[model samples]
Target chain A: MKLTILGCYSATPRTDTNPTSQVLEINNHMFLIDCGEGTQVELRRNKIKFARIKHIFISHLHGDHFFGLVGLISTFRLLTRETELHIYCPKGLKEVITLQMKLADSWTNYQLIFHELTSTESELIFEDDKVQVFTIPLDHRVYTNGFLFKEKAGDRHLDMDAVLNANINVAYYRKLKQGYDVVNEDGVLIDNNKVTTDPNPPKSYAFCSDTAYNEAIIPIIKGVDVLYHESTFLDQHASLAPKTKHSTAKEAATIAKKAKVKTLVLGHFSTRYDNLNDFKSEAQTVFESVELADDGKTFNFD
Target chain B: MKLTILGCYSATPRTDTNPTSQVLEINNHMFLIDCGEGTQVELRRNKIKFARIKHIFISHLHGDHFFGLVGLISTFRLLTRETELHIYCPKGLKEVITLQMKLADSWTNYQLIFHELTSTESELIFEDDKVQVFTIPLDHRVYTNGFLFKEKAGDRHLDMDAVLNANINVAYYRKLKQGYDVVNEDGVLIDNNKVTTDPNPPKSYAFCSDTAYNEAIIPIIKGVDVLYHESTFLDQHASLAPKTKHSTAKEAATIAKKAKVKTLVLGHFSTRYDNLNDFKSEAQTVFESVELADDGKTFNFD
Candidate 1:
């Protein structure tokens, strides 16, 4: 799995810092998250192909979270894209985007699908043979949701020498990989474990942003291989966190620690802070494994 | 008058080249025109303060022309701006912008007034004591209008030496500046022309973009001091101009020459051409004085 941070700063986009937007590549799917203003330029700067973004997920209706969405859709139309695009966002976002398109009189030639999320409980939103996506309801000033992407385990690997020694027929190989015992060519029943080994362990990633300190999400994101949480403020501005419905570095670290995530990535930093290292140090005081997210940064997980 | 080009390229914005957006400063007023995506960041990069801009003029509803407007308004709200902002745009933009704000529940603290233009004829849209802005209707794929900003002629210069020689009283100086014949202290009538010269010829700038090769706007923009016109194509792609409702470089110069504009500035070049100098050479074939618009380039007219 590979994750690329197109932008990580908070509030309005500036010349040096961008707002919240990122790309996650998992199991041949490239998912765009929280496209803030200037996100298209950032994507171009990062050399990410626009054709690869088939699905986009918006956390909320905040301007900093999803203002770039319409521009991106318009660009897709200008490029004459033929691939269908899917958008998963809050219920009201569809109206906002469709209205803009209606005014421009520039409708997309490709199919545009919107998946509005209104459920307050954690539920599976998407599932395929190799991947599953679930929504983690978050507490914010508006209706918001974070997404959790998990990879499904693959089929067991066949022990070729052991299978040949057991005189297993070629047709039975498929059932053996499915962890099923089958009769060999000699008409003898064979154990599945003796001919195949276990598959690699699956990995999971959780993304949460623009939310207050809430323990309710800890269980939903528990034991995630990587957890990206928003830390908009540091310790000095801790008082503003609750008032603004944002999280401080220490609060994000506490959630990361409680969830027992293998790696914690901190992002969505407020532009007021001059030093990003301060957030890293503050988060590390509570959580041992903490990483800072900056614009154009990339992380790879095996 | 000082004009700053924030973005001048056509089509979608890229990492190095931006779409259409510019800042025009005339007679102490800063006017933002055609805010494409990433315009707010471009404004910051150019060091133009947000508070100085009270008016925005959008030529059309195309995504490259006005997509950044809502984000800029939302940023103003985040900045706690209390100054009123006025927007002049096509008829459908108000509904499109207000709906996004309503969905996000993020209304601006400042008053946002919209002046929807639907006239096919040239009309005055804004005027104050020192400046007047008129719409130069143009033909495009959508309803479009260019803006003509003309600085109202200032009061005639005092010509202090001539006034004092005529023994004019301090109380009559205001009348003298208004080009009135005023009685001097000795009760003698003094001629206005003898005391004062004509104020610097009122400068005018016409901005026409995203339009076809229509001669209807020639009369409205005739004899303007500077004219910024869209040249989306080169001579090689002249055939695509009418089909796309865009203008070629030579076509733009032809309009400039026929209108007798002092200087013609070509912008909105298609990204396919790598050399911008070719546009300048192509335009010079029809008009003697021509300039190319580039991102971050500024032009000052005295």
Candidate 2:
């Protein structure tokens, strides 16, 4: 799995810092998350192909979170994209986008599908053979949802030498990989464990942003391989976190520690703080594994 | 008068080139023209203060022309701006912007006033003591209007020595600057020309973009000091100009020559061309004075 941070700063895009936008490449799927203003330019700057973004997930209706959505949609139409694009966002986003498109009179030639999420409970929103995505309900000023992307375990690897030694027919190899015992060519029953090894462990990533210090999401994102949480403020501005429905660095680290995530990626930093290392040091005080997210940063998980 | 080109490309914004947006500073007023995506960042790159932009003029409803307005508006709110912002755009833009704000539940603390223009004829959209802005209706796929920023003639320069020689009272200085024949301190009628010289000729700038090769706007922008016109294609792709409701570099030059504009500034270049000098050369063929508009390029008319 590969994750690219197109933008990570908060509260309006600046010349050097972008608001919020990321690209996650998992199991041949490139998912765009929280397209803030200037996100399209950031994507271009990062050299991410626009066509690869088949699914877009917006956390909330905040301008910093999803203002670039309409521009991206319009760009897709201008590029004459033919593939269907899916948008998973809050309830009212569809109306907003539709109205803009209606006013511009530039409808997309491709299928533009909107999956509005209004449920307060955590639920599965998307699933395929190799990947599953669920909504992690978050507490924010508006109706918001973070997304959890989990990869499904692959089939077991075949022990070629062991299978040949056991005189297992090639047709029975499929059953062996499926964790089943099958009859060999000699009509002898063979154990699956003897011919095949276990598959690689699946990985999971959780993205949560623009939320207060709510423990309710810790359960949903528990034990995630990588957890990207918004740390819009530091200890000095802790009082403003709750009032603004944002999380401080220590608060995000606490949530990551409680959730037992393998890695905590801190992002959505407020532009007021000039030193991002402060957030890293603060988060590390509570969580041992903490990484700072900056614009154009990339992380690869194996 | 100073004009800063934040973005001057056509269609979708890319990593290096922006779609359409510029800042025109005339007579102390900073007017934003055609705010495309990433305009706020461009504004920052250009070192333009957000508070100085009190008015924004959008050429049309095309995504490339005004996609950045909403984000800029939202940023102003985040910055706690209390000044009133006036937006002059085509009809239906207000609904589009209002709906997005409603969905986000982020109403601006500053008053956002929209002047929706549905006029097909050239009309005055904004006026002040120092500057006057008029719409130059252009033919395009959608309803569009270019803007003409004309600096009002300044007070006449007083011939200090001549004023003293004529024995004009100091109290009549204001009247003398206004080109009135005021009575001198000795009760002698003074000729206005004898004491004061004519004011500097008012500078005018016409911005026409995303338009076809229509001569209808020639009369509206005729003999302007500077004319920034859309030149989306070179002569190689001249055939596609009218079909796409755009103009070629040669066509823009032709219009500039016919309108007797002092300097023709070509912009809104298609991303297909790698060399921008070709646009300048192509335009210079028909017009003697041709300047190319580029991102981050600034033009000053003194």
The alpha-carbon deviation from the true structure for residue B242 of candidate 2, after best TM-score superposition, in angstroms, is: 1.3
**Cα lDDT tens digits for candidate 2, B1-302:** 89999999988998889989999998899999999998998998989999999999999998999989999999999999999999999999998889888888889999999999999999999998999999999989989999999999999999999999999889999999998999988899999998899899999999999899999888999999999999999999989988989999999999999999999999999999999999999888788899999999999998
Q: Note the residue pairs that clash in candidate 1.
A: none
Which regions of candidate 1 fall more than 4 Å away from where they truly are?
none
Worst 10 residues of 2 chain A by lDDT: A169-178
Q: lDDT by residue for model 2 over A26-103, one digit each (tens)? A: 999999999998899889888899999999999999899998999999999989999999999999889888878887
Off by over 4 Å in 2: none
> How much lDDT does candidate 2 score?
0.93
Q: In every candidate, what fraction of the native interface contacts is reproduced?
A: 0.84, 0.84
DockQ of each: 0.85, 0.83
Consecutive 10-residue window with the lowest summed lDDT within model 1 chain A: A96-105
Interface RMSD of each: 0.9, 1.0
lDDT scores of the candidates, listed in order: 0.94, 0.93
Winner by TM-score: 2
Model 2 error, position B16 (Å): 0.9
